[model samples]
Target chain A: MMNSPICSMLDIEFPLLAFSHCRDVVAAVSKAGGMGVFGAVNLSPERLREELDWIDAHADGKPYGVDLIVPNKFAGKGEKLDTGRLIDSIPQEHKDFASGILAEHDIATDELDRTRGISGNFARNLRAEGAASSLEVAFEYPIKLIANALGVPPQVMLDLGKQHGVPVAALVGAKEHAVAQVNAGVDILVVAGGEAGGHCGDVSTMVLIPEVARALKEVGADTPILAAGGITTGEQMAAAIAMGAAGAWCGSVWLTTAEAETNPVVKEKMLAASSRDTVRSRSRTGKPSRQLRSPWTDAWEGEDAPEPLPMPLQSMVSEPALRQIDKLSQSGHQGAKDLATYWVGQGVGLMNQPLSSGQVVQQFKEEFAEAFERLSASLGD
Target chain B: MMNSPICSMLDIEFPLLAFSHCRDVVAAVSKAGGMGVFGAVNLSPERLREELDWIDAHADGKPYGVDLIVPNKFAGKGEKLDTGRLIDSIPQEHKDFASGILAEHDIATDELDRTRGISGNFARNLRAEGAASSLEVAFEYPIKLIANALGVPPQVMLDLGKQHGVPVAALVGAKEHAVAQVNAGVDILVVAGGEAGGHCGDVSTMVLIPEVARALKEVGADTPILAAGGITTGEQMAAAIAMGAAGAWCGSVWLTTAEAETNPVVKEKMLAASSRDTVRSRSRTGKPSRQLRSPWTDAWEGEDAPEPLPMPLQSMVSEPALRQIDKLSQSGHQGAKDLATYWVGQGVGLMNQPLSSGQVVQQFKEEFAEAFERLSASLGD
Candidate 1:
């Protein structure tokens, strides 16, 4: 029941948009009155089609969206490496280091090839050309929004969004990037802070929100802004609105929800972790992404650690090892459990409880009302 | 104009608190219906007394506070190095690196010892013992508040505050530290985030304020929180309050004001800088302190740069060369002008105009009301 422009632009009752890889969470949040955005970066084109099909039917015709990773730049983007040579491109040193991490955890690193479920899709989604297949699937659905998590969305995506009457949102961590995205014809900007889980610049949301808003006004752009990063509560949503964000775009808050696709082991770690228990490192994604502090992450930050390779190359080394660790951890491997970690924001401290996706939406409405009332009270003298 | 608890506690008309090293800024802000805190960390006891005397006489009986830097941990805390030994303790390698940066910028590396005004006072104030002398001077004045910048205030500061019926405040960058400060008898918590000007943790103000608020509630402490870091306007102030901060405590906003002690060269750079320009590096004080981007800060973060020495030793190497650079930059030296920088926050992007201390406070009130109106308008829909 917020009056931010985003609510009407997206045809959602509330301005909160939950981001998750789980189709169930997306459908539930959309049905619960808030928009649900499915993270499709890890899904194959076929898988994405099926997920959107499921969400379309299960979302009860409520608004839902899809998020694709189509970074403007990545390693081997120009070279156009096929899957075979791309896998071969990873240095043996990095391979050993990633494998060595799991080896130390007493997990067998010999069977790293079992992670095709994510690697194939991740490699395919590493660039806009590959992501076009997924976009084709997303556009076919009756979606209200589509977002790009890294860099400015390509001209093709913007054009398609215009054709379909769906808004194209790009996430930015700095004001200049926000300006650039707006100039690139992005309909909405998710101004994320450094405390965000995924790739982010050094500016904080508190500063970025106002800076982007003022910069947008200066440049004569009316693009709406959805605040992201470290926002897990409705009170923070109100704060975002006060700072000129039209609404909140939350990602990590759903990671530990009952219907989330998060690895059970990592979900438990996230629930127990505090704000101080995360570090922004490039080891996982070849960009500074915030992840829970664990033996695996700490080793990469150590003095003897090699500089992480660029994205896709770094992902080739990390995802397989992490996937193995995630599997072994669930099957009674204590060392793997100790070394396991996943992307999470500093707001993990505020997300200790597990709730249904719809329940989380309900909780947000109640808390948002409480926070608004509190601010209204402050207006009195 | 607002009913935040900090307003009543500080006996100010607005909940805004201006932090500045200039007594003029402090006096002006307090006289303009807000609390003005005098940053006394860089002042000698005699100088502190003189400045306080000036403020007391000129403040027109308005409320004001004093801040001291008594870090919980620093290099050479218990060693009790005398002036001669402390000066000698700085490694020549660091001295050469610092001198090399200035020399490359065409500033003279010679005469590094001429900075007794701040070096001697700073050397003395490196520990709680030296800070106690300044505290004694501060207690003699009718200050309404006393704050510690680095860590929990020592027991004596707490005891003295209770003895004098003055509120003792402490700055915390994390939620645990906030809880510990409140439990240590501090009446107020300055929850500074990584986006703050000086020493700060990696958590953003958007996350830290709510994290600290929930932490204090969990610990059953009712200590009031003043949000700091990346906050420069009344709209951002309202956002901080909406996130559960009692009020906004701003430092960077005053650095470029007419009455601020900022060097003209550095102030110009800050005015031109965006939120992306600052870097949090240990090169300044052997702690992650945010400062304006300049050639000087860039050199330290480059490859092959030596690891910054611990606290006071690093300060010794940095302060002399920076003081020289600051002097030459104002005297029409191009290279020195390019090298000049100062502590600031990401909020520096929002601080483009040069207003008086009183005008900044007045503008904050107006912007805050407009933001409240915007939020209330949202509630109507």
Candidate 2:
């Protein structure tokens, strides 16, 4: 039933919103009738433009959104180091540690050359400028909503969304943070629990959803709360709505979909994985991102291995090695496969079959409706 | 640092008490001057006598406890079913599903021999009788405390503990549950969060600890709280104490210790595992237990596999398969190795090397002292 305020506000068939880094998944979900928020963290200006343009042409005028990762604790306002300088300031010990592990695994050390200067996900320099560019590109298309992934949306992003007559959403891990986002003029709150993929804080969705939603209401805020993390099936989506959330926001489920741009080798691992297969480790992005546990993460976990550098510094140090791991894994190197990892959520265990993103959306709708009927039937029973 | 009144009240060096099923780990922790709570879920009366006798002999006359898994939920409230009757009642479809998966993995189907009787870490009976023998055996020992692993200690257990001049404890996963247990005459509240091994409710330690401790204080309940779950190092113990917990209780850390009767093959995996390597799955014992993901879990997650049976029923259906998997895994069967799983916690990732149980306790004490000093230094800075 579209009785949930989030579903009514978004005018969707169900209260499930899928977040994905792949444009194809976004387009498929939007076309299939649930809102899809495309993660634009790693996309270049041109690549983002091409993606939005494609969505605009194919979405059948359906509502969709864009997501950016702008955290409150970014290399904050002090003497700010530029990307190149930050890269240089990383300790040689951390670099040596990463390379040494790669060497110990018998991976070609020479492949490290190809990984140099590779800018992975997240903005490394002048993130505000990049966020503005992404906002501009998204607005040029008919985007209905925008989200800041890691923390509160910037005042500029909020103002831009307001000017464009679109909703500005913020991803938050705590109730206090949700209140802050609402105070800062966010239109929607995406409450992601620790069971989520990518960046998350330690709170489970079953508890966090109602807590954040209740906090928003108590504070005289009506910002629709979209419960994120660990939501994989339609029943879970129904449960989220039942738990006072306007909708369920999902990401990891998309990685197993046919439209996902996940590495083929890693995708195979994910397909073979259960929801129990994921771990929250900083080895990938230098934040507590839930990912598939591969030997790469195990190597960093050893006592002798240097402690992971913080945030961007750790990401910068490990990205080169990870890129190489991906390349070698793709080529079917046994050692590299052992070292390869991909970001995912605890919901991975529930995802046993590969479905098209559209099929996923459709199944979610069917399941949501079935669950609603089951709940209703219990009253009579 | 050990001057907390709860410590003296509980007759322990620190209020922190690790709850586990292994007698060796329990004795080791008690010998190290902290308390150890032995989980008695799987022990028969004779076996438990031997364990308590061993603990009494080796614990150096220090305070220790016994923990029994008496989940508030169970099957057959009015009448008890015989083992043959319960086994016969298991849906053939579930048995077929288990057989098919084992067949696919090339694990011997003969290992499902029904004549061998029920197997696993708990008795097959779904009645309170399942844990009764263990509880009776525990009362024979001079335990300093008696705890219920899954819920509030039964009134009989509390009465028994009171009769023996020992404290009764109950494990709670939520703050609300803690408040309820405190009102129910529990002298000590074992707060186990989602990151803990075995059955854990969905709440992170960081939030759950403060919430429960604060709630207890607000209500004027003097129930001593032992923070369990993901606590591994002494620093975490300090952090829990800082959050108003008397001390920290641990399980996963002991699983990697030399004195632990942990599955040797599984211990090897735990040695290399990180905090992220574990998953909360109901594949074991029919409740959500944090366990390492193996191919057996993955097999059950597949499309054709029946959804894991609920609680005791599921545990009943799967334990036979798991026991066989463990045996094959020990024999170096590649398929079974992939399928073998173990109960663990997020703390597994932090254990870089195996140490004697005594040495592990020593490190915890040393680390705890250092962490406090670090915090105290930060205060001056």
Identify the candidate with maximal TM-score.
1
lDDT scores of the candidates, listed in order: 0.86, 0.73
In model 2, pairs of residues that clash are: A274-A349, A275-A348, A275-A349, B274-B349, B275-B349
Task: For candidate 2, give the docking quality class from DockQ.
Answer: incorrect
Native contact recovery (fnat) for each candidate is: 0.75, 0.01
> Estimated TM-score per prediction?
0.97, 0.55
- State which candidate has the highest lDDT: 1
Q: Compared with the true structure, what per-residue lDDT tens digits does model 2 show for residues A1-381?
A: 355556666766666788988888888898898888888877877888888888877778888889876666644323344567777777888888888878888887665642243363245323677667777888887788888886678788888898998888888887778888899898888888787887787656644665576567678888888878777777566555655567788998899899998888888888776445667777766778877877777777775777666766787778888888888888888888888888887766557678999999888777665645533332221
lDDT digits (tens) for residues B1-381 of candidate 1: 567777777788888888888999999999999988999877789999999999999999998999988766766676565656666777777788888998898888878772342366666776768888999999999888999887889888998899998899889988888877887899999999899998878899988888888888888888889999999998889888887888888999999899987899888888889988999999987878999989899999997778897766677778878888899999989999999989999999899998998999989988887777877777654
lDDT string, candidate 2, B104-135, tens digits: 78887875765333443354323466566567
Least lDDT summed over 10 consecutive residues: which range in candidate 1 chain A?
Answer: A114-123
Second chain alone, TM-score for each candidate: 0.96, 0.93
